[model samples]
Target: MSPDLKTSIVASLESAAAKAGLNLVSVTQGTGFNGQPTAVFELGLPRQESLGRSLNLELSDTFDFDKPDLLPEMTAHLAGEAKRLRNPRPDSYVTLGGLPLAFRKFQWPFHRSTSGADTYIVHGEIRLEDGREHGLHAKISASVTLTFAEIVPAMEQPYAETFIYNAVRKTVDMGQLEFLKSGNRQPVPVTTRYYSRWQKKFLFTETDDNERLRYLLSKVYWLSGVLGGSKPVWIADPRDSQYLNTGEADLLRMAGHEAGEGLMVLDGEFAAATPALMARAAEYQAMLEAALDFTKPKFNESMRSGQANM
Candidate 1:
């Protein structure tokens, strides 16, 4: 990229970051693992430089600097990322069924699968974050099919994070992933099946209005009531709206209904679980238990027949 283009991109990103309460400390150009030119964006919270994160962008393949709309689109993407990073646990998420998991240690800039498979893979781990010390988690290798990879603009952190995270969550929801105290890295295939070319979007799970409402309540109950010391949690996260096949305004509307029902208190786009919601703790606990059970490996007739020998 030309120096002028780089400068313009950096300036736009910095402005967006500042508006979103993040400091864009620096933007450095480097070579990515795929041998492509990459831009590394270092960001920090205001007055807390020690707590910082790096977001990577692949420049050559992902953007066309000559396009008039490129800068604005990039700026909008950065702003959305900044909002997600402002959350108490940006890497943490709650499943629709109430299982809270924190995704971490992801090896980014997706690599060609070494297993000779026609896919790109990123390795990561997800730990159960239900405000308990059970230490249950899973190591995973998320693989993107070559066909599916075509639709992804870039394999870098900024572009692929939300969809990959949602794929993992969806895998768990489908009972295809097992969390254990220890285990080898299991596979989570991300294929074109998760995307709708017609809709031009990714769909993790099909949820109705009732399911959406329950998901919002469960998110507040766990993220705020259980883990966040009763602080309000952002309810209308764009990442979530994308994952749930809904819009931010719809999420806010659901939050408003939740407030009316005394299930939570809404402060703009943030919400905290109310006592009325907490009173149904047993119900939430049961949901988590059921979700956990669903994720466990079930034995087939043949496996069960051989269990006695084992």
Candidate 2:
């Protein structure tokens, strides 16, 4: 898409935001995963005292295929990510504060993707200091992409007012209102406090790793029930297991590790923990004798010859 198209869309979006009573904070342009142009708009409104909530409107033109059915692709991508995280090669290993913490036990309770939108849930856990662990729960959403083909037309009649308004409205309408009703404005600090206290309280517990995992899962499941108005079964179904593949579990584990690292970072405990985590990961990988699998793939001349052997 041309720069002109991007500019027009941004203008239209700003106008729409104004109509919707949202104050525009900033609008910046960047590149998407495939080098396609992207614009991010930061918007929010005053609630009670502090800046109520921050909302982001991200527009990208990274359309790889025209009207592509992204459901399977998104699921496959998550599956692949999970696999890599489960059995990360030495080089591909993720590090936080220089620590090579790994994630474990990934589960996807929900996933939905279309050409327009994508959303998924990831559940896992990461081991922390002194055999302590924490649950990693994420609900990620990749919003709809807006192409130049869309921008040009939107600049004309309706002027993208409906599109922009709906995009911003649905986000707030869905959960933000409920969150305000629950009277938890500063959720990040609240979550951090709970996590820090939990870690400190359990630091000296003699509970086994399995018991720790059970506790983490139980807490997350209960939280989900409270937030979602439905209790998720704590059991792992064989059919659900079928959705995952090799290495996906590894990614799930890595995600968990990342989650644990985030909590530590928030609590100011990660700096002192990195070196030991990296050492632990390296030693664990060495014990597995599976470090060679991370090596780069070699090109096969015979396969490229393409003489229809099959």
Candidate 3:
């Protein structure tokens, strides 16, 4: 399910990358307890010159990744997500070589590219001075190359799109990060609501989680209990049994939980004469009618026992 893993990683990475002037090139997922994933990403960019600037980022073999390094930090995040999917971490699954820098670098007098020109094709062997070894095995490297013309074109000016804002939103969503001091970005609140007629306290908000399934199961269980439970019954006399006193009868019949013949009992909270609650009264009324019917026959049958009154 490389595609599946790719889709999942890309979905997460693109969202994170977009706000940072980058985008996921691709993600390849493999199988195993902790199979390594290979993901490629492109910055929202025109393939630029020498994969632009290469700065010294430390990833010590003994640096205790426990210490903070941006690449490790970011990769760690990606790996955590992999863990969520029950997959292996990047370190465990794949051999991540030196991180490469891909961007544009203006040559000396930095002349931009000439587009749609029938004039002439310029050529030069451009080499990117990226990797170097400082004292004590400290490595500095540049893993990219680019043509000046390819990097910056004269016709179309490159506009800087900082992924800072979107990145901030994603970071805040993660909640692991306090706001980064990189640029202007604010955390937005996520609103979640839960409502069910079967239960009270139907609202829950989280700055962290939107527990949709929990609410769904709770509502489901409540409904199952109700639909599968015995109904409460309260009987009262029904004076007019025609078409449910028209609108009033209709409302009460519904509220009282009537099923053609029997009025339904209701929860105690909504026992007022509200249109819905009237059904309880209707159920009571049906019960009264039954009792009255029984008594009327009983009165007649009892005449033999009390013939003088009859």
Candidate 4:
């Protein structure tokens, strides 16, 4: 990419970030995991430098700088990203059972598995964030099968980010992933099983009205109440809506009901946890413990005997 085009992209992203109350710290060009050109956007809050994130966007070979609408489209996507980053623990998510996990260091632009598995893989780490200074985490190699890859519009960051993250969450929810303080990279297979061809959608997990309410409560409690110093968080994120197979309006309605029940305080599209919600801290803690135990690796008599011999 030419320096002029790079400047234009940075300027547009800066404007979008500012409008969303974020600072565009810098933009750097680097090589992606797939050996393609990548732009890394360093974003931070207005005066809080400690709280920030770096977003990696891979630029495909066929990218055209001359396209008149390209800049606008990229800017629109960055604006949405800015909005998402405004949430407390933007990279973190809560499981159905209340385990809060923070995904980090994901090498973007999926690459083919070198082991000849006929799958595209991206590496990342998911850490347990249970309001603790130190906790368990897993280095993951998440792979998408060829059939499942066809459903993805693009292999780039902006296009595949949501579904990929949701896949990791789903893997954890199904007890297919285990978190440890130290361990080898584990495999998370993203296959056609996650897709519904008839509905033309990616199905991660099934959640009901009561489950949705519990999810919202857990999100606010952990993200806002525990981690964010009681700041309000956006409750109707499209990503969460998609993960839950529900509409954004439905999430907003759920938040409204929770606010009426005094479990949370709503600020338009955002919600903050209340004392009533925090009162269930023990319940949420128990859920987290149970989930951790469920995901722990089990050893049979033979494996235990082998370990004893070693």
Q: Estimate the TM-score of every prediction.
A: 0.83, 0.25, 0.17, 0.85
Candidate 2 weakest ten by summed lDDT:
186-195
TM-score of 3: 0.17
Residue 209, model 3: Cα distance from true site in angstroms? 42
Can you write out model 3's per-residue Cα lDDT over 24-50, one digit (the tens) per residue? 444433221113222333333213521
Judged by TM-score relative to the true structure, which candidate is superior, 2 or 4? 4
Clashes per model (N, Cα, C within 3 A): 0, 11, 25, 0
Name the runs in model 3 displaced over 4 angstroms: 26-35, 38-310
- Give the best candidate by TM-score: 4
| Model 1 per-residue lDDT tens digits across residues 62-126 | 34433453445455566776655555665678998789888887766688987799999888899
| Residue-by-residue lDDT tens digits, candidate 2, 36-154 | 46666665542441123344445553222112343233233223322222221201111111112222332212112333343221222322111223331212221223331222222
Clashing pairs in 1: none
Per-candidate Cα lDDT values, in order, are 0.79, 0.30, 0.24, 0.78
